[model samples]
Target: MNRTTPSTHPSSDKGHSVVAAPVTAHPLAELIAHEIRERGGWMGFERFMELALYAPGLGYYSGGRRVLGQRPQDGSDFVTAPELTPLFGEVLARQVLQALDATGTDEVWEFGAGTGALAEQLLGELGDRIQRYVIVDLSGSLRDRQHQRLLKAHPSLVHKVIWADSLPEAMSGVIVGNEVLDAMPVHLLSWDGARWQERGVALAPQGDTPHPTFAWADRPAPEGVRPPTEHPDSAYPPGTVTETHGQAEAFVATLAQRMVRGAAFFLDYGFPEAEYHLPQRHGGTLMCHHAHTADADPLAMVGDKDITAHVNFTGIALAGQEAGWEVLGYCSQGRFLTNCGLGEALARTGQASNAADIQSRVALQMLVAEHEMGELFKVIGFVKGPWFEAIGFAHGDRTHTL
Candidate 1:
């Protein structure tokens, strides 16, 4: 694979910027081009995303990239909550402990356990209260990293840690997924004045470039293919682009079916269906992150960056509820963490006079402050057997909104 510095170019189509660079021969690019050709020169964006992120050994997550870190200087793409500070996981552990006790389950299932930082923190805090810690991650490289980190962090309990590529046939545990649903592939739907179309990827015409260049191509959407909006299509102005979370919703439904009795929580940045498909919000939430920078062009850097879309919590709740899982609660991450005792934990850290303490204080603030991750990020919980008031959503439960 050839590596070259990327330069940003303002895109005229949408307000989002794109990484404009010379087309270089990359293995993943070639593979995708071949697939597009085999599929008659057009491939759905969802399939492209699936291959770009989770296709065996060539995808981004599985391609041995250092994806999670505090800074771009570490050759990482983005920073997650657990990576931001240990306080995040510590505060979340309270809810997990409550769920374990409430559900009478000893196992903890974590999806997309990046760097295993949260797992390590949870394992350390929960101690022997956890019988089995199962991690379901598609990235082999990340699994290796998680294994090493967990082994060193919790030597005695490492034996109880299990790594699986997919969910088991039947299981009972408290499931946790941080920034996981947003990564799942989503179908892109663009609205025109007349009708809705499915946005896809197609090979650009041959030019002086050395490798194949991909471009957006739209086709008429199938019948009933439109955003889940209460308002009529005419309400949205032309050029409105959005995503449908089929894969993510299916994931929740499947998990609800598999789990005999347990609770699950997902933390991510998203909004309800009404807010998601708003008229003024023309550009969708589809974004790409690389080296701590964000861009809108997923076609530019095939397997080098992370592609994600905002979660539609309303749809997620319906899916789970339809599949026999009761909605425990839904609220902002800031409120949930605060309700789960984040403020108390901060107090225990003492006055922020020392540099280390100050840094901890800042990280904690970012996790809860409305201007930062607190407001935009949300937490949704689900229970299979019986409904118990989750501590995280005790005070600020927004399940009514969902």
Candidate 2:
């Protein structure tokens, strides 16, 4: 959502910061604090993040907040490609069509279908070709919003859409997950040249305020635990902070395992392993977003903001490969979208000076510009059945990079 990379700074008490001392207790803060106490005043950053983003009825996504939109004026936290323009899905649908035909499947599964904007675009473009459109999302509130949007937009085709609470034992479809992996909980790790530690969350002592303030707390990581990097500990400068995407990797492995026949395409902003863990990237990619603005402090606003980390494409590819899936390709979003005809679609808008056409053109540029989402956002495709040359990766395929 919010695409800002903020550096982590050292604090007085070890490397942790006393993030905030709230004037009043946030309900979610209290809940997390109680859990910290229950767990002996410490909680792994992964669990803390899971609670902060997905705890039932209190976390960010499950808290009934309007998260995705074009701007802050709509009371939305951040914007996604689908929200930026319908052309994203329209172009992606071309790739999905190829995957569906190659795998001989008529179903489509979308994880974390934010606002259902992409779903609407795909469903409209693909039409009767798709027998079913299954959405697997954790946010009940967002699911309700998606239902209403889809119903109003495609009244006759609404019945083809289904909401699934969880993945079944077996499924066949072209799966899509846009901006999903980055949101999964990641384990925070900090290296101090000599040793590495697992950074977690601890409640700061309660002062005059009734609520608890959160702070960073580092404990010796398990003997073998470390960042998935080829570099040695000596290569990392002291106080270098980073993240390991166990959950995200496992999620991909699970998807690879469950799909009987189909392909999956995930689009997100991230780097390959080598770039992700470069010595200069010591600050790590963990970030928080609220009202379309971004910050590095996730412990401050609690459930009021969205927390995320950059996806490790190398790790994702390995996970899927190890779990019986073949990598179709990986490349920049710009290249993939262009291969799928995004540039051609933009050209169709012509020289019309209408506001809608102008806006569409601008959005298309943002999607493919190197300084914008084009270079930063990447698409990775996986297939469980026979591999075919996907149109999205017809050119500039970077599968070897991963």
Give the Cα-based TM-score of candidate 1 against the true structure.
0.94
Instruction: Enumerate clash totals for all models, in the order shown.
Output: 0, 0
Model 1 lDDT tens row, 337-399? 999999888997767688877777788888898877888899999998767989998887888
Lowest lDDT block of 10, candidate 1: 1-10
TM of each candidate vs. truth:
0.94, 0.97
Q: Which regions of candidate 2 fall more than 4 Å away from where they truly are? A: 1-24
Candidate that would win on TM-score: 2
Residue-level lDDT of model 2, residues 170-242, one tens digit each, is 9899999999999999998988667888889999877777677888888888898888888888998887888
